[model samples]
Target: MEKNYFNLLQLPVVLPIDGSLLSLHYQQLQRQFHPDNYATAPDNEKAAILQQSASINAAYQTLKDPIKAAEYRLSLEGININEEQQTIHDSPFLMEQFMLREQLDDLEHAQNWDELTLFYDEMIERKNQIYAQLLEYINQSHWLMAKQQLYKLRYYAKLIEQIELLQEKQFNL
Candidate 1:
């Protein structure tokens, strides 16, 4: 049986519009539906609990992350995004992704920690700006604009991963 997002989210249909509050609701659902809690239950009950837990986890993971949430919302609108089968029509976003990929490649080969730090700082600033725009777009019901912002968010998320790797290298050396 497919679970409704509202049920998986463990939230009322008319949940608060606050993102932070939604995150808290996701945590609450995690506590309630986590598979560990069903370890001692009957076999049939455990099976049902595990299935529900997986659905809850999938829902929370998508909803708590801005990019995933936007993508999920788009899917609901029948805007499918299969990276292999579907092409993103946003040329500017594609260009930005290419630029970011080049910068990440350059950073990977750079010997100077200062350069990496500078790049990390720039990406963080961009992320914050995008996040602010995301909040505004969401409030204004600009779904397309919010989806565009989410594309930027994905770039920042990858940049964060790169920064973490660089930090680890610095700590080890």
Candidate 2:
């Protein structure tokens, strides 16, 4: 039973997916296949439900995260990302990212929350800009550019995660 994450969530494969509806559908599916509800069922049926429950959970996660959703879409388009080829070939963007990371790494313990917020917002804006281009390229069937955009998004996503972790550490101190 091959299923795209969007299909499993019963939603269209597009940006700005409805989170609330996805949650509702996910919970309903969980309840339907919960092992407690099948205690008296046959052994094979129980195993099947367990597998389905796992698949449903994975699908829910895939559709919940924007970056993951983009990767899922690419997979649907028969684009297998070569995981080993992770670096972006765009030299200028790589330099910008390197500088951004260096700046983040240089943050002091006394870094202002407001300043951190601004930095976070700036990274998010960059990610969003790339995503907009990605959507355009995808719609136009520009496979290479779309894949490049995904790589860009992945970098930003990882950078954002680092910033968030740093923010938590700084704020807690």
> For candidate 2, lDDT tens digit of each residue in 44-150?
99999898899899998888887777777888888876668666789999999999988776664547677777889999999999999988888787877888999
lDDT of 2: 0.84
lDDT of 1 at 153: 73
Q: For candidate 1, lDDT tens digit of each residue in 1-173? A: 66656556655433223577677877887788777988899999989888877777788777766567666765655555444544446788778778877877777677567787888888888888887887677667776776667666776887788787977888788
When superposed on Cα atoms, how far off is each prediction in RMSD? 3.9, 1.9
What do the candidate models score in CA lDDT, each in turn? 0.71, 0.84
Q: What are the per-model numbers of colliding residue pairs? A: 0, 0
Best by lDDT: 2
Displacement of residue 93 (Cα, Å) in model 1 is 5.5
Worst 10 residues of 1 by lDDT: 9-18
lDDT of 2 at 78: 88
